[model samples]
Target: MTVNNIAATFLLGGIALSTQAQADFLRDGKATLGLKNFYFNNDSREGAAKPSKTEEWAQGFMLDYKSGYTDGVFGFGVDALGLLGVTLDGGKGRSVGSTMIPVGSDDRPVSQWGRLGLTGKVKVSRTELRYGTLLPRLPVLVANDGRLLPQTFEGGQVVSRELANVTFNGGRIEHATGRGSTDRTGLAAVGGQRESNQFNFAGADWRVSRDLLAQYYYGHLEDYYSQQFFGLVHTLEFSNDQSLKTDLRYFRTESSGKNSSGAAGYRISGYTKEGDGEIDNRTWSAAFIYSIGSHGVTAGYQSVSDGSNFTQLNQGGLEGKGAGGASLYLYTDRLTQSFTRAGERTAFGQYAYDFTALGVPGLKASMMYLRGDNIKTVSGDRLKEWERDFSLDYVVQSGALKGVGLGWRNGKSHSQAARNQDQNRVFLSYSIALF
Candidate 1:
């Protein structure tokens, strides 16, 4: 059945049956649409000639509908999401890279594009089953939300919260769509394009204590990649006026499906065996942040051991896989020019302060820096790059724009192998809950 048909049927079933009994079975279901008047621009220090800069403005819309479940031992419900993008200004010289919207077969950008996704949900107590469109964020597999739009998946999922402090989730994703697309395609890891669909994953997160937690995740992409992760987070109090926080993360990845060289061409670059073959990637990182009132400081280090580059779906900077939106720990997934990959080592530090300590209610500022060395490059010397990020955020405490939020981002990236990059982004966002 079509996506619209399935979603419409579920919506009707819930409403029609409730109406027959004169009961408000679906009392709180409503449709919501949003518009983000977004402006984005990126420039590389290399100058003209080469494609170093991109700029655009567009209105992104997301129409979502959620329904109340039927009352019973087994409850049933459905949800639908409609995404659309309209270009306010974009053409040959004006259009940037793959930021706002994807280019079309015509060679230039399309006036607009959209997609429709529907999901059927079944619930039994705290355990829920969802089939159809999926958005996953487990360690091994994370959906991309880095563009004016978000990338999604097509699959089945089972999420259970049987334990009060523990959440268990597992799923199989067969297809994926880029943040800028509606059409679903087979699954593939970052920089992996051998056409291996089935992606299997399972994970559990335990809230060990009020301020401490642990997580374990495992994932496999048919013939492309296999990954596992372990993570820990904790916050410790030292005194009435001081505290220390730690966030530790680690991952081990190997070759799977087609990339195993069972049939497909020599697995894409650097993914072979540990040093001479394909697939042997392991990475770990730790970050510590200490906050005392409005003044906070943080430091982190990350290392990767693999011939091939580490990969993950990033929703910032770059719109593709393995990109980081904002990160100082080296693994930051900014999709900008390219995902940071290959022989790599990184160290970073950040500091943030709350204006409330300074007597200002809704003002905050932070700055961070990350430096990476020994990055793998096909050319000669290992690649080297670093970035510095500064952010200022403000919110109106009272009045019409009370909950409105404004954010600013400025960054610069320099690479020893490629051109330098500079970027600036300003975002204005607000949300209203209509009951």
Candidate 2:
């Protein structure tokens, strides 16, 4: 159904339900107001166009309301999200590449912008159907939330848990509103200019045991590409607060329709087999994490096939600047770069510590590094790159400021395929319950 139809369903359901049902819906409903103050700065060290730096500060507000399903064999409910962003600083030159703020006609940052979203939902037995605004976190499509506001999609999704040890998910996504945008746009690949209004996906997760899970998913973007994903995760517990976790992921992707025919607007960008711009790639990664006490160490290796760069849904090449942010379900999707170039091989490691054992119950810190080499270049050369990232976060555990969170992140990247840059972000956030 269309967005309008979904909205109408919410309205009509509210009015048509019996008084007892309405009472149940409202009784179990909840609302929250979230606040975030963010500051971002990115300095291009080399190999970038003019306006070598992007700096901005902003305040964000989000209101979330969720209603419980009515009391009946078939239940109905609704959810609403309200997002607002106000620029505290930065304009024109300094805001060039800041994706958290919107730009205006004169190439300046907009003072403020806001949007509202609604979702209609229905439930029966152990299955649920939701339509309208969505934030999907599946293997093929991950809604971006790296900025002040999160990316949202216009679509319909169904999740079922009728099976004892398995869960099923499927969806059809038609459009997206970027994390920094107030308008919705069609979906496309990272460098694709043409819009593909239909994206179909289905997936299933099976819990094999108490500590092991298996997943399989398929996604198809009309006229663009199709992909299949397989994943496995397991955790092993040891003595003395020690544990080991293993995660394995694999993806196979290939061109379809226009993309397969090498059409201009539908073809992907970046290195491809014979420079044909076709989508053909196999990517995989495996990570192992060992935790002891309050410390965790992780190591992983990833590989991208030589035929083409890994592909997923991205709207960066679309018309709006805010349309550029996207998130990938890869360990390599870091703060500054995604090691996804064709023929790339990357090794990454991370060290994280929680301060709870050290008397600071709300503090945590992490450091990560990734090095990628053997990146295929169109000129038949191999390129290499590396990145280092650091993060520190704290949340108040008690008192008046309980649940208030503060965070700082820093990343430096040196790359042969793109610009070298240093980036920093600081944010403070809190959420208030509302009846």
Candidate 3:
């Protein structure tokens, strides 16, 4: 069915329920509205060939509504989301690409744009089945929310937690809408042209102990590749309000279907073997963090095999379809570079502090640095890169403006194989609850 038809059916079904169902829905319904004022700027240190910088300012509004399940052994619920973005300041030269706003035919940012999403759900005991819109955060698939609006998916999902300390998830995603655009596009790997309509995933999380957790997940993109992930997390407490945390993650992936032999022009964009484009890779990382009071220190290392760059659902090649940006599920995925090139190894460290420990609440600051080397480029050259980032955030602690937030971020990246760049962002946000 068409998207419009599906939306209409969900709405009509809710309205046609019994009077008792309607009363319960209204009684348990909840709504919220959020406001965000954002400014983004990026400076490319490359030669005059590229634009010197990109700067834009915009405002966004988000309205969310969730209704309670109707009365019965098997209950039903409905959820809706409304998103709107207004261009406050952006010129043709500054908005050449669709970085934070959709670009029009004239190669300029549009004045405004918006979209609506709806989800229908049914629940029994501790399990729920949902259809339509989704913002999923599983081990294998995470929704992107770095721009003015969040990326959403069209899919059906089932989540169950019938067993104590264990949760299971399964889903099939068909399409995705970019964070900066209003159009929905099929899924593909980064730099790939062919679009695939099927992205199936399943996963489970088990809390082995109060301070330890384990996870396993699998994902398959038809005509592309399949992947498996395993993760473990543990925390230990010490005296004097000090604690240590450890995180380990691993992923194994291989080509499937058309990508196995590179038929129908189904080839990944990055470095691959000479014969045919195939996915063969193993990536892993381990991180350790120590905290004392409100201060945290973290250290981590990550490695990617020599076969291919780590693969993930990316739509960057679909720029003509209004989808340009993508994100990876790795700590090395930073503001500038992902550090996932073939045969790459990365070491990173971070320091963070919360002002609450110093008698000032609602204020936080952090700094991070990463260095990567031994990258295998398509030209058969070894490359290296490094990045440094800093951020500060503050939120209103009390009074009428409580919960209002202000944030600032700065980053610098230098690479031997790519252009060097500096980026900055400033944003203000506020949220209000509505019945």
lDDT of each model, Cα atoms only? 0.69, 0.92, 0.87
Instruction: Indicate which candidate wins on TM-score.
Output: 2
Candidate 3: give the clashing pairs. Answer: none
Mind sharing the TM-score for model 1? 0.87
Between 1 and 3, whose lDDT is larger? 3
Residue lDDT tens for model 2, 5-67: 786688577768899999878998999999999999999988649778889899999999999
lDDT string, candidate 3, 96-166, tens digits: 45488888989889999889998888889999988888899886788888778888888889999999999
Give the per-residue lDDT of model 1 (tens digit) for 1-435. Answer: 644465567666666654522243456456776555566777876845545567766778877777667776777788887788887766765554355666666546677877888888778999998887777777777666656667777788999998899999998887666665545566555444455557788999999998899999888877666888899999999887688999999888777656666444325454333343356677888899998988899998888774567754322322233222322223455434333466678888889998987778899999888888877766654678887878888988899779777777787778775678877777666654432
For every candidate, C-alpha RMSD to the true structure in Å: 3.8, 1.2, 1.5
Ranking by TM-score: 2, 3, 1
Off by over 4 Å in 2: none
Over the full model, what C-alpha lDDT does candidate 3 score relative to the true structure? 0.87
